[model samples]
Structures are given as structure tokens and as C-alpha cells.
Target chain A: MNSLLVSLRVALATMLVCVGGYTAVILGVGVLTPDSAQGSLITRPDGTIIGSRLIAQKFDKPHYFWPRPSAPDYNASGAAGSNKSPTSADLTDRAKQTVERYGATQDKPLPADLAAASGGGLDPHITAHAALYQADRVAPARGVAREAIVALIERHTFSPGGPLTPDRLVNVLELNLALDRDFDPTSSSK
Target chain B: MTAMVFILLIVGGSALLSWPLGRYMKWAMDPDETAGPGRQKLDRIFASIAGTLGTEQQGWKRYMVALLIFNIVMFTVSFAFMALQQHLPLNPDEMKAVEGSLIFNTVASFTSNTNLQHYSGEASMSYLTQLCSLMWLQFVSAATGVAALAAMARGLAGRKMMGNFFVDVQRATFLVLLPISFVVATLFLFGGMPMTLQGSAHAATLEGLQQIIARGPVAAFVAIKQLGTNGGGFFGPNCTQPFENPTFWTNAVCMVAIILIPMASVWMFGRIIGRVRHAGVVFAVMLVFLLAKISGAVWFEQAPTQAFASLPIEQATGNLEGKELRFGAATVPLWAVLTTSTSNGSVGAMHDSLNPMTGLMPMIGMWLNATFGGVGVGMINMFIYIILAVFIAGMMVGRTPEYLNRRVEAREIKFAAVTLLAHAFFILVPTAVFAVTPWGAATLNNVGPHGFSEMLYEFSSAAANNGSGFEGLGDNTVPWNIATGIVMLLARFIPIILPLAIAGSLAAKKPTAQSAGTLGVEDVTFAAMLIATILVVGALTFFPAAALGPIVEHLKFMV
Candidate 1:
């Protein structure tokens, strides 16, 4: 009984130190890290808070650049992949759908990222190659030159190869948001 | 190639850093240190707790009892919180309470330091449960392993009594895990990882679709989870999830944290036994095994899948089917190897998507379970192998089987054999049971060898207390929950108990001077022999299972 009591006391004390004291200190530091510390929320020009800079958002319209396809229907509350194996029929169907949707041909290949859901199922970025491939479609819808759209893709393109992150990828959400903020077709036309 | 260098640097850096970390651990493990006048007040409180617990000086059995009581107390509290999560505070999402069997499995998994998560963290567990129960157990359970290792070290040194359990647990928590976790948590928080009590945020997607983004006190859980080798994730996608591992630096920090203490504990073992050379030999064996796993994973994962060979893009770019583009082929394989090597099961990429050979590497590591394994228990496992090796080598060469001047007798060998055999028994038996049963067959997400590998991996993970999954097993059912719960319990305690029993038996013997006929454990030849013993033991036990699952799968993939 004494041992159990002492164990309880120690457990409570350790919890106080770790959960209360330690977390309070670290959380204070987290809150100080700008918007990123709290889900990386970005604000639109209308003062409304949007999603994070990191998490992918749905961009299905022709004018907007699309992020990678999400499983669980882009529900952040339940972030998970299809977890389908290479030999899985569902995986094959999904890949086929993605290819047909993207209009890939023999000469012009779709980036693998476009055909596959990432492990997280919430990847914000797609390959630079994938991003550029959509330029023709996005350019016409936005009433922009192909050259300007390619430039925008280039600006948003991040090399995946890194001492940190290594690949040539573009953040789809940030690029689309930039397309709205910096390159308004209405103002350019006017 | 740069990814390989980065991984090598992290491993090399952590190994070098373990030297100083081991010194501090040495101080913490020493029971003879006086609190002194400057620390009288704090020391008195600790001393009182020790007194209350009757933890002054205990034989191994008494010590085990104390440890069990402590663990049971923690387990009970966590189980209660999980069972009553709906009524708990910090549950902003109004998540319901977990059912009985799942609660049982979850608590067992965490308490065993296995953390084989059957449920998604974000959608299932409330913030209160995540913090108070899940994160809380990760610390104590890991500290328990470190405490147990310290006790075993005491027995190895031939101490008449193993040190007080309360003191060992307290010191391991306060002196070792607490400080390191504090710094790591702070780094995560400041590095843009979320640490909020607010529920999921309502946000608009680029498509103007409304979505609720889940948020919680992730930074704190993420820190201890990795550092403790408690690989449970705060979110379903695990470390690969951006919120848990935001930047490249955080990913590196987490990767290094998993093996930090386990590697350090090896050095501490050599320090405790007063034989750096012996520890060096053991460390080398672990490294070779770890490197072999990494090479195999990287080699296979970088090749295009045989199923996808006809695709020109896949042939040109290698297998990107289930990998994060940011991590690419290079870091993903390294992460798989390191995570499994330490039994830190947090995944940065989908293991289910891996090629057959790539997926087998982590399984092989788990089967060995001592290639720089979990925080402290890993080195203890290696020590058990060393004991077995000594006994075998002595018998072969017509010498007296001795390690650290203690004779390797029948009782010691019995305990060691039980420990080794129990791992295989728990893994292979349960896997077989599941393979034949409709209940187990129902859980498989794939057919044939892939499905066989998934089941084998599940039991291997549970037995090894390595929690990463193939993610293809539909294992959230009641039978899986309860069955794995029981497996986790038996597999964890049996290995721990038998090893400690052997340590106790060894501690009671008087040290004899090394003679010409004594087996030299630190010799290079003995190191080679020990490596062979570990491999041969693993192969004899698990090779058939491996051949049935990964090897056959690989062969089929070739055609």
C-alpha cells in the first residue's frame, strides 16, 4: 500500500513537471513563433483567416493550381492515405483516374506525385514538373500568358533535394494564393 | 548520396555525444551519492518517498515487485483516463470515450513502451488523454526501461542487492529523460510545430471547401514520443505529418532522438561494468546490423518496382509511389532503417508502399530486436546475447564460461534461454494462430505473401515493442486489440523479468580473477563470434517466416 501510494505521488509529481510546467514553458515559446505556432493560419485580403501555409487545400477549379489528390476527401480531421498497395486494385483505379484527369500522353508524362496520394495524404506540394504541366490549362482560364504562369510556377518551385528537403516541388496552395494576390487577371487586363 | 552522409553524420554525432551523456547517466545511476547540505530539503523529500515505498535496499525479486507496482499504478490511471475520455477536460472536439478492448490494448502498448497504435491519434484520442495518459506513459515506461537497465548493471557488477527501484526511477526521470525532453520539446515548439489546447480549426481550402483542421498539444507529445523510443504518433500519418515534423531540422532532431539514449545506454553499460572495450565490441555489432538494414532498404527502394517497370517515368525516377516528395528515395529508406533499428516506429513514409526487400529491412531489425534497440532494454537484450555467446564459446573451447568474472551456470542460461525463446514464441505462435484463424485472415488488407508479411510484421512489431506498421492491416477490431494487448504484455514482461533474474543470479556470485582458460569477451574474434551467434539465432528462428513473406514476395516481384 505504501509503495502504491508513493508511486502515485511520484506519478502525479512527474505529471506536474512534464505536463504542466514543461508544457507551459514550451507552449509559451510556441505561441511566440508567429502564425505557424498555431496551425500556420494565413489571412486573406478581407481579414478572414484561411488555412495553413503547409497543409494542402482543395483546388479543383480550372483557374486554380491543384494540390496532390487527397484521401479521406481532404478532411484534415482525418488525415490518412488510401494505404493501398502497389498491387491493389483501388490504387490502380485511383492512378488511372488521376492520369485521365490530368490528360497525360506518351510524350508528356504526368509527375508521379499527381497520380499518387502522399503518405500523409495532406502534402501541400507537387513536383515542379507536375505544376508546369498544368500551366496550359490554368493559363487559359485565368486569361494569362503561358510564360507568366510558368514564371509564377518557377517562383514557387522549391528544390526537393536539400540538406533538408530534396525534390523540385511547388507549393500549390501558396502558388494559387499568389496567383490571386499578385497576378490578378482583371487588373492586368485593365 | 548526401542523404546517406546526413544519416551517417547524425548517427556518428549522436554516438560521439553519447560519451558525455553516458557520464551523466553514470552519476544518476550511482546510488551512493549524497544529497549534501545544499540539497537537504529536496533530498529529504526524495528520501521520504523512498522510505514510504520501502525502497532502501532490495534483492532482485523485491525490486521487481516495486517496479511492477509503480507500473500498474501508472497503467491503471492512464486506462481510466482513456476509458473516460468523453468526460475529460481539453476534449474540445467532443470526441467519445474509447471502448474497453481498445483502451486495454492502448494502455498495454504504451506501458510496455511498444506503442503499437491501432487507432488514429487525432480522430480517436482527446487532448486530455493524449497528454495525461499517452504522453505520461511514454516518459515513465521509457524511464522504467532505463531504470531496469541500471538495476541490471548493478547486478552485473555483483552487487548483493540491486539498487532501490524508487531511486532508479526517480533519477532516470528527473536527471535523464526530463531535461533532454524539455530541450527537445522547446526546439519543436519554436521550430513552428503546433502546441495548442484549441480544438480543430475551421478553415477554407483553396477550392473554397470548408474543412476542420485538427490541432492539439502535439509538440510536447512529439518530443517524448521520439526521445523515449515510444513511437506513438499524435496524428495518424505520424512524423511524416507536417504539424508533427515541420522543418528539416525537426525531422533530424526526431531521428537522432530515437537512438540517442539507446546508444548512450550501451556506453553506460561499458562504464558500469568498467570495460569500455566490451561495450565497444557490442556497439560495433549493432552498427554493422544497422548499416546492413539501411543498405538493403536504400538499394531496393531506389529501384523501380517490378510491377511498375513498364512505366517510363517510374523507371527513370525510381519508386516514388508511396514516398513523400520532400524526403525523396534517399531519406525515406534511411528513416525506415533508423526508426526500426531503435524500435522507434514513427514513419516518415508509408511502409506499405515499400518494395518487398525494402519493407523486410525493418522487420529484420525487429526480429533481431537488439541492434541498438529501444532506450535501455535494447542494450540489455544485447547483454543477454553476449551471455549466451559466452556460454557457447566456453563449451566449444573447453574453458569455463565466465563474463565479468561470474560463471555462466544453468540457472543463468535458463533465464537467458527463456528470454530468447519467449520472443520467438510470442511472435511466431501468435502469427501462426492469426494466419489460420478467420479472425486473423479478416484483418489482412492484401492477399498472398504481402498479406503474410503484414501479419508477420504486426506480431514482430508487437513482440519487439516496435510500433511502426505496414498500414495495410485492418487491425482496429476487438480481437486484434485484445490479442495484441496480451502479446505486448507477455512479450514485454517475460524478456524483462528473465533477464533481470539472470542479472540477480549473476550478482550473487563472487568475482573470480580472469584465468588463461577464461573466454575473452572483448576480443575481436569473440566480437565476430557474438555477431554470428546473434544472426544465427535470429535466422534459425525467423528465417522461414521471412522467406515465406518478404523473400518470396521479392522473388515474385522479380518476374
Candidate 2:
């Protein structure tokens, strides 16, 4: 009984210090962070919230760079992968369709990210190869020069270090937002 | 191919880092010794924390009671937070309360350091609950395991007075877990994983689609989640979600972090008991098993099964269906072995998607449970094996059983038996019960052998307190949540309680001088016997289950 009481007392005290005090410090530090602390909210000129830089948004329009296809649709409330077996007919059909839609030639097969769905249905970025492949289509549709679009993609391209240090990734949302700003300047604020 | 190189780098780096860190861990846990002036100052600081808590020297029973009560308190507080998360401040997502059964499971899971997340983190929890409740327990539960090991080690050294639990917890948290986590968290934050209190990041896709990106203070959680070997993720997809893992450097770091402490604890045991060579024998045994499992997993993962030959994609790039392209082939399987070997169950690739033979590696790793197991508990589990081996070897050689000169008698053997048998009982009995039940059958996403593997894997994971799963099982229902909750509680506490009690019993006895008839654990012959015993015991208990599940699944695919 004495030990239990001591145990309880010590536990309660530790909880107060570690859970209460330590958490408060972490929260304080979190608030001080530039973007993510506030949800990484991107805003328009009128201060209306647009979206977050971390999450992926739907970019179905031909004028924009497409994010990787999400499985079971991009429902944030219900995050899931398609969980398709490699041999599943559904997965194969979808991949084939995606490859054809992207106009893959004999010389260049569709990048895995382009033809396949990401584990998280809401992957925010696409492979540089996928981005480059779609640049030709996006430039002609948006009435922008192909070279200018490729350059824009290059600016937004991120190489996430390590062995993939040379392999670039383009955030579909960031590149799209930049497209809206460069091509249609008046609507950049809104 | 690059993944193989990265895996080598991480393994080599951790092995190099473990020597100094192991020495530091021994110094920190030992009350008598201080490294130098710098450590003396830190020791004084820790002493005050113990003073504030009124913690003094405790015997084994008193130490166990204190640890249990603290865990109980933590469990209750964490449950309350999950239940009332909606009303809590910092809930920008306005997430509602978790259901009653799930709250029990979640709290029990975290308290045991199992971290079997039934609910997706972002969808279910608020930032406050994640940080204060879940993350807090991650630190404490890890500290609890370390403390248990220290107390038990003191007993193994035949010390009458075990160290203070309060002092152990404080040092483990403030000194070890905190400093390491800070460096890793800083690395993650700089490396692109987002740190935010915001509910979710909303963005527009290039295809003019609106996407709500799930964002949280992931970097901080990810660091402790790996470093502490508490494998819960802030997202449902766990580390596979790009936001949680982000880049290759973070992924490599996370894998290294998973095995780092468990590896060190082996050497720490050596330092504590003043038996460095004995620790090396044990470390070599663990490394052999770990490397064997990793190699097997990698080989199976790289070769596409005949069943998958029908898929064009599998033919082109091996089995890339359930794996992230960023992690590559070798790292995915390496993560499987690393996570299971250390009881750090965070996965970068889908375990459920691996070939059946590859899937068996992790299950067997967990079954063995002593191959560099969880934090401090892993070493204790290894000690249990040591005791058992000593007893068995004594019988074989026709002499009295002794370990470190302490007599191994019936009571010690019984305790060790209970600890080993408890894992099989909790795992097998529940699996059988679930296999017959309609609820358990309903949760399976695959049928036949694969379905059986999924159910078996759930109970195995729970019993081992290694929380990675088959992922296809719909385990959010009342039965899974409650049953696994109970299994986790019993498996975690029973092993801990029994081992400490045995250690206490052993500690009370006077050490006898080693006779010519005595068996030393440091002998290569003894090490071989120990390895054979582990393999035979594991194979006998689990081979049937494996045959029914992954082994048979592998056979069917082969034919």
C-alpha cells in the first residue's frame, strides 16, 4: 500500500511536469514556426485562406500539372490506399488507362508514380519525369510557352536529398499556384 | 540497388555509434558512477528530480509497484484525453471523442509501447491529445522499459537494493530520450516533414482539384516514434505517408533510430554487470539472427512470386504495388526486418503486400522476441533466455545450474517458463478464439491461408508489443480492440513482473565460486546451444502457424 501510494504520487507529479509542462513548451515552439504551425495556410490577397502547402489538391484541368492519382479518391477524412494486389485486374486496368492517357511512347514508359496510385490517396507531389511529361500538354492548353512551363517546373522542383538528391520532385499544388500567377496575373491575388 | 547501400550505411553507422552511447546509458543508470565533471553535474540535476518525487532506494517488489502505479495513472489520463479530445484546446480539426472500446485499446497500446493504432491519427485525434497524451506516453513508456531493465540488471548483479524507479524514469526521459529525440526531430523538421498545429493543409492540385492535405506536427512525433521504438504514426498510412517520412535521409535515420537503443541495451548490460565479453556473445547471437532475417526478407522481396508473374508491372520492376518508389526495393524489406527485430513496427512499405516468404521473416522475428527486442525490455527478454539456457545446460552436463555464480533453481526456472509460455498462450489462445468468431472472420480482407496469417499476425504483434500489422484486417471493431487490449496488458506486465521477481530471488542468494563443472555463457559452445535453443523453441511453437499462414501461402505460390 505504501509503495502504491508512493507510486501514484510520483506518477501524478511526473504527469504534471512531463505532460503538462513539457507539452506547453512544445506547443509554444510549434506556434513560433513560420508556416506549418498555422496549418501551412496559403492565402489570397484579401486574406481569405486558399489551402496548405503540405496537402495535395485536385488539379484535373489540362492547364495545370497533375498530382499523382489517389486511391479511393482523395478523401482526407478517410485516408486509404487502393490496396490493390499487383495481380488485381482493377489495378492493371487503371495503370494501363493512365499510361495511355499520358501518351507514353515506346521509348519512355510511364513513371511508376504516374501510372500507379500512392499509398496515401492524397500524395501532394509528382515525379519530375511525370511533371516533365505533362508539361507539353499543360503549356499548350494554358497558352504558355513549353520552355517557360518547364522552367517554372524547374523552379518548383525539390530534390529531397540522400540518394535521390539528383532526382527532383515537383509539388503539383505549388507549381499550379505559380502557373496561375505567371500566366493569369490578375487572378493571382484572388 | 541504392537502397541496399543506404541500408549498409545505416547498419554500419548505428554499430559505430552504439559503443559510446552504450557506455553513457550504463553511466546514467548506475547511481554510483559518474563519467567526469560534466556528468556529475547532470547526475546532481537528476538527483534533485528524484528528491522532488521522494524516491529512494527500493527493493524489487517496491520498484515494480511504483512502476505499475505510474503506468496506471498514465493510462487513465491518456484515456480521458482521447475520450474528451473534441472539447480540448488545440483541436483545430474539431475531432470528436474516440469511442469507448478504442480509447481503452489506444491507451493500453501506448502504455505498453505497442502503439497498435486502430484509428487513423489525423482523422481521429487533435493536436493536444497527440502531443500531451500519446507522445507523452511514448516517452514515459519507453522510460518505463529502460527503468525495468536497470532494476533487473541491478538484481542480476546481485545488488540488494535496486535503484529508485523515479530516478531511473527521470534520467531515461530527461537525459537519454530527450537529447536524442531533439537532434532527430530537428533533422526531420529541416528535412521537409511539416510541423504544425493546423488541422490539415488544404491545397489545389494542378488538375484544378481541391485537396485537403492532412498536416500536423509530424516531425516531432516521428522522431520520438522512432527513437523510443514507439511505432505509432500521426497518420493512418504510418510512415509510408510522404508527409510522415518525406525523404530518404529521414527514412534511413528512422530505421537506424529504431534499432539504436535496443542494440545499445545489450552493451549496457555488459557495462552494468561488469561483463563486457558476456554482452558481446549475446550481441553476436542477436546480430546473427537479425542479419539472417534481413537477408531472407530482402531475397524474397526482390524476387517476384509466380502468383505475381501475371501482372505486367511486377514483371517490369519487381513487386512495387504496395511499396513507395522512393524507398526502393532493399530498404523496404530492410525496414521489415529492422522494425520487427527491434519491436519498432513503423513500416515504409506495406508488409501485407510482401511475398508470403518475406512476410514470415517479421512474424518469426517477433516470435523470437529476443533478437534486439524493444528498448530495455529486449535485453531482459534475452536474460530470461540466458537463465533458461543455464538451467538446461546444467541438466545436460550433470551439475548444479549457475549463472554469473548465482544458483539457478526451480523458482527462477518457473518464472522464466511463465515469461516464455505467456507469449505463446496469449498469442495462440486469442488467435484460436478469434478464428472461430464471426467478428474476427469479418475483419479479414483476404481469405484462406492469407486470412489466417492476418489474424495470427494481430495476436502475435499484440503479445510481442510490436505494433506493425498485416494492415488488411479491419480491427477497429469492439472485439479486436478489447481482446488485443487485454493481450497487450497481460503480455507486457506479466513478462516484466515475473522477470523482476526472478531477478530479486536470484539477487538475494550468495554467489558461489565457479567450479570446473560450471557452464559459462561466454563459451562459443554455450552460444551455439543458446542459438539452437531459441530457434528450436521458436520453430516448435510457431512453425505450424507459419505453415498454415505464410509458409503454406509460399508453397501454393511456388507450385
Candidate 3:
């Protein structure tokens, strides 16, 4: 019983120090860098919040670059992957449908990430190749030359700059926003 | 190619950092240190706060009692908090109280340092519950394991008493875990992870769709979640979530954080017992196994996903299903191996969508359960393997076994064997029961061998206290919650308690003088022996199950 009493005291003390003190410190320090601490939210010139730079937004329209397929439809309230095993028939059917949607064929296949659902369901970026693959569609819809779309993708493409860097990728949301600013699809030449 | 380089960087960077961190841990955990005036002041403050609890030196039995009682209190308090979350302060989203069984499971899971989540954090839990209850446990439970290891190391070093449990816990939390976590959390915040008390943000996307993006005290929660080997996520899909792990640099840092302290723990153990060379040998053995698993996972994932074979999409970039584009294929597999190897089960990619053979690598890590393992407990698990190795080697040479000048009798061997047996039994028996019954089959997200693998992986994770799962299993049901909750309890305490018992027993014996035939444990040959013992024991127990799941899945894919 004495041990139990001591245990209880220790537990409370530890919680106060950890949950109370430690969290207070982190939150306090977070005040200095409000932008990153507030989810790196992107805003319009009028200060209306659009989305986070880190988070994916749905972009099914032809004038925008598409992210990877999202199993939860980019629902941030609850994230999930398809959780399908490699041999599951559901996995195969979904992959095939994704390919068909992309107009992919044996002769001209889509980028792998373009045909797959991301684990988190909110992947913001797509491979540079995947972005370029959509150039034929995005350019026509925006009434811009294909070269202009290609050049825009190249400008937005970035790697973390190391031997350890993965493939250069473009943020789908950022690129599309830039497209609206630069190309102004509503005022198309066509 | 860049994937391999990143993996090597993570591994090599962790290994390099562990040395200095281990040295610091030695000074911080030592009870009798009169090192400096600064440390003396800190110790004095700790003593005043703890009163008798910090001052009293305990034997193994007393230490174990205090540890158990403390954990029980923590569990009870957190359970009540989670159960009544709707009424709690800071619940901005008006999250309801959790269901009874799930609350029990979540409490048990966190208390044991096995953070197997049945529910998604953003959807199910409020911010108050996430920080006060779950994140609090992440720090203390990890400290509990480290404290236990410290006690055992004291005993093995022939100290008169294991140091005070309360004191050690405080030191681990305040000195070791807190400082490191603060730096990591700040780094994560700058890397674009959110640290807000505001609920999910309402965003109007450029597509004019309303997107509810969840954000919370995630930076603080995730820092300890990785550093403590408590792999619970502030959101579902763990580090795969952009808010939790915002960039490739953050992902790489998370991978390093997962293994950093666990690797440091081996050096700390050696420091405690004054056996740094032996610790190096043990560290080497763990590194070899870890590297092999990493390589296997990376290599196996290079093959096109079998499910996509009939599709016209190009998979020449390797398996990309369930992988984030920024991290790409190689980093995902590398992260999977690293997470499982350290029992830090946070995933950058979904384990369910890994190629069949790549999926086997994490399982292999869990089955062994000692390749760097979980924080302090990893070293404790390795101690069991070392005991078994020493005994077998001694018996073959027609001599009694001795480790570090103390004899290893039947008492020690019996305890070690029971610990190992309990781990296997908890995993295999529960897996068998669940797989054949509605309890498992009804919950499967895949059919055939893959379904079996999911069940097997859950049990293996529970028993190893690994907490990573195949994620395809619908395991939030009563049976899974209750059974795995029970398994986590048993697997965690048994392995911990028995090792302490062995250490206590060894402490009682008088030390013998070192001789030429003291069984050189700090050499290449001993490492090989230790490796063989781990593999043979692990293979004998788990091979048939592996064959039934991933191996069969791989062969079927080939056909």
C-alpha cells in the first residue's frame, strides 16, 4: 500500500513534468515560428486560407496537375491507404482502372506513382514525369502551348539536393496555383 | 542508388551519434556520481521532489514492485481520461468518449510501450487525450524500460542495490528523453509539422472544395513517438501523413530518431557493467542483422508489384503503391526495415502494400526482436540471447557457464528460456486461434496467404512489443483488442522481470578471478555464435508460419 501511494505520487509528478511542463515549453517555443507551427497554411492575396503547402488537395480538373490516387479521397479527418495486398484482386482492378483513367497503354505507360494510391491519401507531390505526362491534357484545357506547360513544370521541380535525394518532384497544388497566376485559364487565347 | 545512400546515412549517422549519447546517459543515470556542482544541484532538486522514493535504493523485487505499481497507476489514470474525453478540457472537436474495450487496448498498448493503435488518432481522439494521456505514456513508458535496464545493469555490475526506480525514471525523462525530444520537435516544427491547439483547419481548395485538414499538438507528440520507440501516430498512416512528416528531410530524421536511442542503449549497458568491448560485439551483431534486413527489403521491393502485372501502367520505378512520391520507393522500404528493426513501428509507407518478399523483412525483424529492438528493452532482449548462447557454448565444452565473472546456473537459464518461450507462445497461439476463427477471418482486408500474414504480423507485433502491423487487418474488434492487450502485457513484463531476476541472482554470487579460459565474448567468434543462436531459435519457432504467409505469397507471385 505504501509502495502504491509512492507510485501514485511519482506518476502524477511525471505527468506534470512531461505533459504539462514539456508541452508548455514546446508550445511556447512554437509562438516564435507561427507559420510552420500553424501547418504551413497557404493563403491568397486577400488572406483567405486555401490549403497547406504540405497537404494534398483534390485536383481532378483537366487544367491542373493530378496527385497520386488517394484511397480516402484526400480526407484529412481520417487518412488511410487502400491496404490491399499485392495479389488481392481488388488491388489489381484498382490499379488497372487508374491506368485506364490515365489513358495508359502498353506502348505508352503512365508513371508508376500516377497509377498508385499513396499510403497517407494526402500526398501533395507527384513525380516530375507524372506532371509532364499530364502536359498534353493540362495545356489543351488551359489553352496554352505544350512547351509553356513543360517549362512551368521544370521551374517548379525540386529535389532536396543530395546524393540521398529521391526523384525530383513537383507539388501538384503549388504548380496549379502558379498556372492560375501565370496562364489565367479563364482568359485563354482559344 | 540514392536509396541505398540514404539508408547508409541513417544507419551510419545513428551509429556515430550513439557513442556520445551513450556516454552522456552513463553520467546522467549514475546514482552515486559526484561529477560536478551543476549535477549536484540537479540531484539535490530531484531528491527533494522524490523525497524517500528517490533516496531509497531497492533490490530487484522492490524495484519491480514499484515499477509495476507506477505503470498500473498511469494506466488507470489514462484509461479514465480517455473514457471521459468528451467532457475533458481542450477537446475542441467534441470527440466522444472511447469505447470500453478500445480504451483498455489503447491503455495497455501505450503502457507496455507497444503502441498498436486500433483507431485513427485524428478521427477518434481529441487533442487533450493525445497529449495528456497518450503522449505522456510515450515518455514515461519508454523511461520505465530504460530504468529497468539500468537496474539490471547495476545488479550485473555487483552493486549492493539497484538504484531507485523513481530517480532513474526522472533522470531518463528529464535528462535523456526530454532534451533530445525538444530539439527533434523544434526541428519537426520548422520542417512544417504543426504545433497548434486549434482543431482541424477549414480550407477552401483552389478547386473550390472544402477540405478539413486536421492539425494539433503533433510536433511534440511525434518527437517522443519516434525518439521513445513509441510509434503511435497523431494521425492515422503514421509518418506517411504530411502534417506529421512534412518533407523528405523530416522522414529521414524520423528514421534516424527511431533507431538512435535504441542503438545508444547498447553502449549505455556496456558503460554500466564496464564492458564496452562486449557491448561493441553485441552492437556489431545487431548492426549486421539490421543491415541485412534493410538490404533485403530494398532489393525485394525493386520487383514490380504482382497485383499490377496485368495492368498497362509502368511499374519500372519499382513498387509505388501506398508509397509517397517525395520519399519514393527506396526510402519507404528502408524506413520499413528501420522502424521494425527498432520496434518503432511508424511507417512512411503502408506495410500492407509492400511487395510480398519486402513485407517479409519487417516480420523477420520482429521475430528476432533484438536487432536494436525498443529503446532499453532491446538491449535486455539481447541479454537473453547472450545468456542462451553462453550456456550452449559452455555445455558443448563440458564446463559450467559464467558471464562477467559470475556463474550462470540453472536458475538463470530457466528464467531466460521461459522469457524466450513466452514471446513465441504469445505470438503463435493467439495467431492460430484468431486465424481459424471469425475473430481473424472476418477482419481480413486480403485473402489467402496475405490474410494469414496480416494476422501473423499483428500477433508477432504484439508479442515482440513491436506495434507495427500489416494494417490490412480489421483488428478493432473485442477479441483482437482484448487478446493483443493481454499479449502486450505478458510479453513486456515477463521479458523485463526475468532479466532483472537473473541480474539479481548474479549479484548475490561472489566474483571469481578472470582467467585465460573465461570464454572470450568480445571477439568475432562470439558474435557469430550469438548470431547463430538468435537465428536458429527464431527460425525453429517462426519459419513454418513465415512459409505459410510471405514465402507462399512470394512463390504464388512468381507463378
Top model number, TM-score: 3
TM-score to native of every candidate shown: 0.96, 0.90, 0.98
Tens digit per residue, CA lDDT, model 1, B1-559: 5767777887788888888888778767663445345444444566566666544787899889889998998899999989999987889999897888889999999999999999898899999899889998998899899988888888898886887788778778777888998889888877778988888888866566897888888888899999889999999889867788776677778878888898989888887777888888899999889888888888887666444333323355566656666655577788888888887888888788787888899998898899999888999888889988998898899877998999989999988988899899888998999999976899887778888888899998999998988887898889889888998888777877888899899888888898777778788888888988998887578999999988898787644
Model 2 C-alpha lDDT per residue in residues A40-156, reported as the tens digit of each score: 567777675566565556655677787777764767656666554333446666776676677765566565666656666656677777798888788878776899998998888
* Cα lDDT, model 2, residue B48: 64
Query: Every prediction's TM-score for the first chain?
Result: 0.91, 0.84, 0.94
Which of the two candidates, 1 or 3, achieves a greater DockQ against the reference?
3
The better-scoring model by TM-score among 1 and 2 is 1
Name every residue pair that clashes in candidate 3: none
Error of 1 at B123 (Å): 0.6
**Tens digits of per-residue lDDT for model 1 on A91-159?**
666666776787776677666677767777778788888888899888888887899999999988876
Model 3: per-residue Cα lDDT over B48-144, one tens digit each: 6676676787999989988898889889988988998998899888788798999999999999998999999999899989988899999999999
* lDDT for each residue of candidate 3 in A1-190, tens digit (9 for 90 to 100): 8767777777778789889888888898899889989888999889888999889989887888888899999897888988888678898888777887778888888888887888899999998888999998889889989999999999999985345675889999899989999998677533
TM-score of 2: 0.90
Relative to the unseen true structure, what is the C-alpha lDDT of residue B371 in candidate 2, on a scale of 0 to 100? 92
Q: What is the lDDT of residue A29 in candidate 3?
A: 83
The worst-scoring run of ten residues by lDDT in candidate 3 chain B lies at B26-35
Which residue window of length 10 is worst by lDDT in model 2 chain B? B305-314
The lDDT of each candidate is 0.82, 0.78, 0.88
